[model samples]
Target: MKNYDVVIVGACTAGTYFAHLLAKEGLKVLVIDKDSEQNLCKRLDIFHFTRDSYDQFDIPVSGDGDAEWVHDFDLCLSKSALDNHPKKSHTKVAVMHLPLFIKRLRERAISAGVEFHFEESFVDVVYNDQKQVCGITTTKGYYDARLVVDASGIPSVVRRKIEDDYIESFEITPRDKFYVLLKYVQLNNPDDKVELSTSWPYYKGWIAPQHNKSGAIIGVGANISYDYAYKCMDKFEKAIKLPEYTLQYEEKGCTPYCRPPLSFVTDGFMVIGDAACLTKPWNGEGIPSAWVQCTPAAKVVAKALSDGKIATKEDLWDINVLYQRGEGAEYAGTRAMLIGAVNMSAKDNDYLFANDIVFCDDDKGPNPNVVGTLLKGVFSGKFSLGGLISLMSASNKGEKLKKHYQKYPESPAGYHKWAKTALKLWKKVGTMADTVKDA
Candidate 1:
C-alpha cells in the first residue's frame, strides 16, 4: 500500500493547478480522475482566465494575442448594448482553448513530480477509527493519504459519502442547476463582441469568438432541463449567423448551483472546484472562480504542511473563512439580487434594456443606484409600481445576506451558529416563479 501526502480526485484546471502548487512545495501528490488520459476534459466550449488572474495562477499564455479582451451585451445587433460588463481590469480576459490549457497545467504538475492515476473511479472515503478521512478507495484499489481533495464536480462521490453535518447542503435542487450547450460555429467577422442575450432572466445565450478569428463558441445557459436547454440552444442558433467557413465542434454539460459551503475543510479532507460549488452564481462561470477559490486553499494547506502540522479541520478552516469573505460572499450576494430579476417577463425585461435602467451602457454594469433609477421611472410613469417594489425587496434581501456572509466565523466553534443564521436568511429568498408575479 502506497501513501501520498495529498490525493486530488479531479484532473480539471483547479485540481491540476492545486497539485502543481502542492508538488512544488515538495509534497508527494497524486492526481486521479475517472476520465482516460487522452479523453480528459473533452470540453469544446471556450473557458476564460480573466485579467490579473494569469499572474496569480502562473499559467503560460499563448502570446498569439489569443488572450484578448471580451465584452458582453444584452442585444448587440439591436444596438442596445445593455450589459453587466466586467470591470476595466477584468474587461480583457484570457479567452482559452480549455483542452489545451488544461493539458499544459497537467504537464506542469507532472514535471513537478505529481503522480497521475487515470481512469480510476472514486468509490468512497477510507476512514480510520478516529472517524477521520484517512484515504480514498477507487476502482483500482485503496491508497492512503494524509489529505484528500475532492474536485470531482457536483456529484462529488467522495464528498457525498461524508457525514451530512459536515457540509452546508447535501444536494442541489434541479432548479438550482444550470444546463449549458456550446457549439463552435464559424464567424464572418472575427472582431465581434461576445454577445449575451439575457432575454430570459435565468436563461441566456452567448457568442464568444475564437481569438484567432477563425470561429466562435456560441452557447446557451438555462436552469431548465437538458432537453429544454438543447431546444433553447437550437432556437438560439437561428438568431446567429450560421457557419460561413466551418463548424468546428459542439459540447454540453450541466452544473449544480449549491450555495458554497460555509466550510470546505473537515477532518483530514478538503474539497475544491465544482465539488465545493465554487462557481459564480450569476453567469455560472466556474473556471476562473475555481482557480481563485482553490489558490487560497492551496496556501492554507501548504502552511499546515510547512509548520509540520497535520491538515486537520481546524488547520484547514482558514480556506473556508478567506473564501467566504471574498469571492464566495460576492457570489452569494449576486444570487440574492438575481432571484427577482430572473422571474420578470420578457417584455418587462426588455423595458429595462430599452430605457438603459438596469444594464447600463456606461462602463459600470448596472447603475450604482439602480433601485433609485427604477423609482424615478415609476414617478414618470415609465415603470410600474409593482416592478419598483420587487426590485427594492430583492435588493434589500441581498444586502442582508451579504452582511451575513461577511460575518462568517473565524473558527469552528462559531460556524454552526453563523451557518444557522445564513441558512435562515437564505430561506427568505424565494424562487423566481414564487417571488415575481406574472406581469
Candidate 2:
C-alpha cells in the first residue's frame, strides 16, 4: 500500500493548483486522472473571467486574490498561430485552451515534486476505524493517506459512494443546465470582431475568436426545461449558421447547479471544484471559483493534517463564508444593475449602448466588452441601469431598480426565503406568459 500526506483526484485547474501549492509546502501529494489526454478535456474555445469583484455572472470568479498560484505556460510551435487567432476587439480577454492549460499545470506539478498517477480511476476510499479518511482505492491499487481531496469535476465517485448519511444539507431540487459549442471557419473580413448577441426568447449566444481566426460559438439554455434543452441543442446549430470550415471539436454538457450536500467533508476526506457543487447560481462558471476555493482548501487541508486536527464541515464553512462574502457582494451589485435596466425606456437603451462603446475602449479588465458588461451589470443589478437610461430618457428607473435590488435579504435565512419567493414569481410569470400566448 502506498501512503502519502494527501491524494487528489482530477488534475484540472483546481486539482493542479492544489497539488502545486501543497507540494511547495513539502507535503507529499499524489494526483490521479482517468486519462492523460493530449487534448481530451480541452474546450476548443476561448474563455475569459470577469474581475474577482464581479460575481453576478454564472462563470465563477473568486473575490479572493491573495492566494499564491502559478500557471504552466508554453509557447505554441505554430508560426501562423497569431495570424489565425480570433480577434478580441470586443473584449481584450485572454483566450484559453483547456487541454493546453491542464497540460501546463501537470508539468508545473511535476516540477514542484508532485507525483502524477494518470489513467487511474478511483474505485473507493479507505477510512480509518474512527471513520476518518485514510486514503483511496484505485483500479490499480490502494493508496493510503491522511487526507483525500476529490477534484473530480462533475461526477464524483467518492462523493457518490459515501453513505447518504454522510451527506450534509443538499439542494433537493436538481438543475440541469445545457450548452452546445461549435467551431466554425474564420470570416474573410479580418477587421470584423467576434460579437455575442442576446435574444429575448431563447438563450444568448457567444462567439469566441480562436487561433487561426476561427470562431468558437456556444449557446447555453439554462432557464429552459431539460427537455427544452435537448431541443435547443439541435436547434442551436441551425440557429447559428456556421461558415464553411473544418470542425475541430464539439462539447456538450449539462451541469447541476443546485446547492450541493452539506457533507462535503468527512473525518478523512474532502471534495472540491464541480464535485463539491461550487458553481454559481446565475451563470454556470465554476473554474475560476474552483481556483479560488482550492487555495484556502489546500491550506486548511495541510494545516489539519499537520496539526492533528480532523477536518470538519465547520472548517469548510469558514472558507465558504469568506468566498460568499466577497462573491455575494458582487452578486448583490449585479442584481442592482439589472433591475435598473429592466425598467429602462427604449431611448435610454440606445444611450447605454453608446456609452458602452466608450467604456469598452477605456476599462482594462476581463469584463465583457463594454456593452455586454453594462447590460449584464444592469440585469445583475451591479451597475446603474437608470443611469444608462438617464443619458437619454432622464428617468429614475435605475433608482427604482436599486431599491428592489436592495430588498434582496442579505442573511442566509433571508436569502433562502427570497430565493424561494423569487422562484414562485418566476413560475407565475412563466404561466402568465404562456396563457397570454395561447389567448
Best by TM-score: 1
Which lDDT values do the candidates have, in the order given? 0.70, 0.51
Candidate 1 residue spans exceeding 4 A from truth: 65-90, 187-203, 211-214, 234-249, 306-310, 351-358, 361-368, 431-439
Please give each candidate's TM-score.
0.85, 0.61
**Backbone Cα, N, C clashes tallied per candidate:** 0, 26
Where in model 2 is the C-alpha error above 4 Å?
37-40, 43-46, 49-92, 164-174, 188-191, 195-202, 214-218, 221-230, 233-249, 260-263, 280-283, 308-317, 328-439
Worst 10 residues of 1 by lDDT: 72-81
- Tell me the lDDT of candidate 2: 0.51
Which digits, one per residue and each the tens of the lDDT, describe model 1 over residues 93-148? 55666777788788888999999998998888888877778888899998888889
TM-score (C-alpha, index-matched) for candidate 1: 0.85
Of candidate 2, the 10-residue stretch with the lowest lDDT total is 76-85
RMSD to the native, candidate 1? 4.4
RMSD of each: 4.4, 10.3
